[model samples]
Target: MENVTLSEIKRTPELLKQVESVPFKLEKGKRYLFVGCGSSYNLGYIAAEMLNKNGYEADVVTGGKIVALGDFPEADVAFFISRTGESTETVLAAKALKKRGIYTISIVCAKDAELSKTCEENIELPFADEESVVMTGSFSTILYMILRGIKRYSIDGIEGFLGKSFEYVDRLELKKFSHFVFLGFDELYGLAKESALKVQEMALQWVEFHEPLDYRHGPKATLTEKTLVVMYSKDTAYEVELAKELKQMGAGVVYIGKEGDIEIPYQDGFETPVRILPVQYLAYKKAVSLGLNPDKPKNLTKSVKL
Candidate 1:
């Protein structure tokens, strides 16, 4: 039986095609804020980074932070992201933003979700909804939707990239490593974080995420032969050197960049939505190898309420 998680991941390219026609656009000169929890939070974080890099001012805050602090950043508009849209903090955060006269928009994969009701407006993509407990396709679909506002950039040869990436990861000996480290910068940093979460959630492995250079500061002390480092590089000389250093430390390394072990050219972070495809597959493959089900992650529910 094909895993539901794998099915969702594979369907992302088609989801992107569907979402591409959805007429999503962001206004210029308006401060934007994004709020969500878990994978949704990571999606917002990546969106915030991409927009800010492309001459748009944006900020991101976890729903829990806004609900706890009762203080949010100044923004002309706020976007609340939730797959199921019933996440307690996210829905509450949307309400709080609405009370402050900030326009709120819910970006959800489900129709008529609680978050959509709490916000001033909603952008629902029910077509991308998933049946698995962990988020897979929707993350990239929403991220691509947000990026499309900046520029309608299609991932050229997406299907080919997906197949090659899955094959590369599948070739690895999953049982050889138990520790996973993901490294990147800016929006890629958000991608690295999401990648780490996939491994932890699906494979139940120890995973960590850090900015590439920051790893040398102190994080490298824990490197072991059992560690597998995944670097999302910008193809910078320093980053390429860092990959070599980590490999020398007995950590298995998979570099993803212009000239990486699994070459996926960087597109100024806009490629992030596509870049995540392999790690998602890696997590699923790891889970299956360990006799675990990626669809139903242990001790987790689809929507975290309260």
Candidate 2:
């Protein structure tokens, strides 16, 4: 029932400094492909969005999609992200890209893993590796590394944020909520998606993710006392109002903004990774409350070999 995921989450700020000096070279003016599964795929989605928005050309695709349907974007280089580096689809996808003369790079938490061995080059962050079936700190660490490599972001003061998020979660009773919904826009939308996955993976909770205003369209029909809607606000007036409105409607709301529940300073999109910390803590706490083991979720493995 014990695992390194919790320890790794607590060590995020220290982990960031360890990889800060790594010579990661993401060439500009070239098309790049980012591929992975689950949290890894979501990180790729965020990275690709950030890179494309900041003077680079990048595309994101899932390893399963590439393996099952052979649908992948053409690119000069492919970066395969896998925490365990042994996911069958990711390793197979790397092999497929390398066969096409595309430069392949593996970003993994462990060295000499199948995906790393299959790719032409690799960047391994063994310090970020996890012992749990679910991803926590490794998700943020690899994401920070990718964003830093692309020269789109640099992070600071996250150590304080890490402590604050843990404290916030410690004070709350997470068992009250039976369902979780996360909302954001653009890069935050990617984060919203990741947040939903975190609860679903670590807590086995019902979860949904959507764009901010879109929830009012049809998703609001499901609002109830058992639901907790988390708004990763851009600090816009409309987003702020929506959080207030949701709270009034009986659904518990967690508004994360410059001055909200979690009190995160919005820095363009750089805060996106850190914005996930509270939700990660929330999920873990919720799992513990439900008498479930966050480290070993049912019906899941550390790596999806098939």
Candidate 3:
């Protein structure tokens, strides 16, 4: 399991190159609905926020919501994303949307999988397929590929950023923190959610996620020496102040932004994919600290059949 997860992580840069060649195109001025389950849904949320910012109308919905309640939103086209392509809920959602006459697109890591077969259009990412229960590189790879298809996103200094991220991650005392909080907004909010999931899935740790300023509303009461607050900052003054206050209050804080721990450039949400590395490393390290195998993760399967 360790090899599976780490293998995917180490191959991300090369995976991005392969994902860029995926044959898919977005029509300008057309509304899009993105549906998926779990991490895939979070990626859709990030994509919706980004596309909306760039003058496109995009809405995100989870496949579970669609399957359980028929809560699909209105849009000119619907895109379904599933890493394994066999997720029942996602495939069902795509089939239902297509039946309603909405043009449907499927993005999966496997070619000729059930989900892809159910859609009118399929953007299969065979190269980004993973064997681990949790997603490491595929999440970032798929997101980057979709973004590149919309407008080229260059990860020019990815190697340097990754090295710095690991350095910061290694220095963190993982077992000291009993709780974790991830803060961000918009696209970063989706990223924050995904980061929290990684820690939960990989380390079985108590994790929370929220918009930066919103963290103070009620969640701040939980802060302590045992809590780790990871701020995916937008380089805003208020967030910097919040991070300072959290640090003074005894919580371990790792701020990711320009001049922060991870020090990623705030480029209109273009750096969202890079923001994931530090937290991913933290999860892996925390799992190891607890003497748990991150690869197997309690009771998880590579793909949810039902």
Highest TM-score against the true fold, candidate:
1
Candidate 2 error regions (>4 Å): 1-3
Question: What would you estimate as the lDDT of candidate 2?
Answer: 0.87
TM-score of each: 0.99, 0.96, 0.97
lDDT of 2 by residue, 1-306 (tens): 454557766777777777777777677899999999999999999999888887889999999998999878989999999999999999999988899888999999997898888988889999888888888888888888877776744677888888888887888657788989999998899999999998998888899999999999999999999989999998999998889899999998888889887889888777676788888888888887888888888899999987
lDDT of each: 0.93, 0.87, 0.88
lDDT of 3 by residue, 162-215 (tens): 888888888878778979999999999999999999999999999999999998
Q: Positional deviation of 163 in candidate 1, in angstroms?
A: 0.5
Output the lDDT of residue 242, model 1: 95
Which candidate, 2 or 3, would have the higher lDDT against the true structure? 3
Where model 1 places Cα greater than 4 Å from the true spot, the runs are none
The worst-scoring run of ten residues by lDDT in candidate 1 lies at: 151-160
List model 1 lDDT by residue over 1-306, tens digit each: 888999999999899889888988987899999999999999999999999999999999999999999988999999999999999999999988899999999999999898888888889999999999999899999999999999887888889889999889989987999999999999999999999999999999999999999999998888999999999999999999999988988899999999788888888888888999989999999999999999999999999987
Top-scoring candidate (lDDT): 1
Candidate 1 overall Cα lDDT vs. reference?
0.93
Best-to-worst TM-score order: 1, 3, 2
Per-model tally of clashing residue pairs: 0, 0, 0
